[model samples]
Target: MEKIIKEAIYIQSPTYIGSYKEEDCIFLLKDISHLVTEKDDKEREEDINDGVHYSQMLPFEDTPSDEYMNIFYESLKENAMKVAVNTLRICEQILKNKGNDVILVSLARGGTPVGVLAKRYIKYKYNIDCPHYSLSIIRDKGLDENALIYIINKHKSTNIQFIDAWTGKGVVNHTLEKACREFNMKYEVDIDSGLAVLSDVGRCAKIYGTREDFLIPSACLNSTGSGLISRTFLDDKIISKHDFHGAKYYSNWKDIDCSNYFVDYISELFEKIDTKSGDKYTDINIKTAREDLIDIQKRFGVDSIRKIKAGIGETTRVLLRKIPYKILVSDINNPNVKYVLLLAKDRGIPIEIYKDMNYLCCALVTFAE
Candidate 1:
């Protein structure tokens, strides 16, 4: 079926909690195949480098076992209160600088929930509803043009602030900037490529909530934490030029879905927590992260920074989505890194304690080179 807001149409899924404001934006996307016959991590990597997009090659791993899921739940309980408060603080700074008329366009899948949380908190604190929309961005393929066109038509591109859940080695952030430049040059339209994320451990973005690199409980699970929506996809056959790319709405997984629950739960904590001024974490210049990434690449004899995903959130992503070669930890016992340690062990991967980095840990993705 279709959702009509003003004059725009968005085909939505029953699995998604409706978050669109009736006056501002259209969440346009197509419901496509959910199954990829799950591939082993190695296969996903090989396919990714061989001129095929990773999202088109595999389905995600099944939900983590109860033990791993327990780690995430515990993290949520321990960190959510303070984290929510800090999030509001950073968001406040962003709104202060950008003004209240900004729109949040989150990078799909990983970014979707972070955008939702920001929108919820903004409304709760300021009594002003911010429109949040999640759209697809593939690393090599660039941003989804059709979706961008749709968003631009519905809202002013100048007011759009792209959102991401976190910054790892800042690949997606750079990719976004490059993609926006390309979009502007190809179509002769301006859309801000500057991204705002809940965490910026990679030190890549200007507007960020925190740069702490801790486990964001939600980073511990797949699909379940994201409105039961599959990672965004773009294949020529599966997505036409004019369609808003595609994603599978996991309606069958609602009973296990914590997508909306995660956002709502965090939003509630905002009420109980004080929004006082604090420097729990602040921005780090991108130069440091860049120089270090290059050093790590040379030291490890690695082929590319693309394979060296740093920070706890990104390390978790390596375990979750990619084939992890090895994990280097500043502290194996860091409470924030419990999920990473568990994921490494569960996958039978090696973990090395090397304490010279800025982040809690770093994950060396399987280097296909």
Candidate 2:
């Protein structure tokens, strides 16, 4: 029993593909950010029209010119502490709402760091050692059923909360909901798909920390920001029935791993916080985001509600992942919008400067005939 348990320690498992190196924790994200190709105009049009999965292909990786890197470094230096403190407060709120015994299973790649950070906060603030698991949730393909099985067997089906970095169209939430339903049917286990995110620009999730659409700092870079794990893939050739989704380990990219820097930046700010009863934030305002998303969606036009991707984080994702027709900017003059403009230009997507968008920016998806 001891040997088996030890063997399973850091095992990628049948549902995961990457081997554990050191605990960078940003594994799958690092790979996807680098490997995924940009969709050309023709290719982008075909994808949006056909409703294909975008993860299968990667765009050319943008090597931030010296200017962008300088800006990114400056942003990280300035904002990492604030983000960490805010995240700690959010984690405390979540723990209070759910009770301290809840299990945190982060959607692999993006949510892992958030989960780890949240776990750290719980330990520092409340002395709770919650277990954090990073699992896969493919956009349309859904969460890995095998991962669900592993959790059920190991943890005996405790209260599970799904975590992510941010939501765009709430694809991860919807994907997990459907995946959990199928999992219950197959394994006779139930895991609530209700999610928690650092930000909710899509207005899809029930529990979240913030609605701010500003650059997450993490979104500005790929595996360098995440641990050096590749994106998860379900291709039959690479993944077998018993195998976890596959990801490549970029051992070569160790020099660029910002996982520690990101974590340390946020964590070091813990001393500055009061952690007192009245000063700490509670998620009383989560409802506002839901209403805000709906209002913005309708204002944009009920028909294009799906196209109106709000929040700076989501807009950045649209620029990265989807065929963006045009960018709706909240503050056209904001220097923060420059990166969005840079990537949009790379893909030939247009940016329309707007006076106001309830969120930071909205990306309209264009389908090509």
If scored against the real structure, what TM-score would every candidate get?
A: 0.85, 0.75
Strongest candidate by TM-score: 1
Global Cα lDDT for candidate 2: 0.62
Off by over 4 Å in 1: 1-27, 34-38, 42-46, 278-287, 320-323, 342-348, 367-369
Q: Write the per-residue lDDT of candidate 1 for residues 259-314, one digit (tens) a residue.
A: 66777678788878764544555554434678778878887877877777788876
Which 10 successive residues of model 1 have the least lDDT summed? 11-20
Clashes of 1: 0
TM-score of 1: 0.85
What lDDT score is found at residue 179 in candidate 2? 88
Clashing pairs in 1: none
RMSD of each: 4.7, 5.6
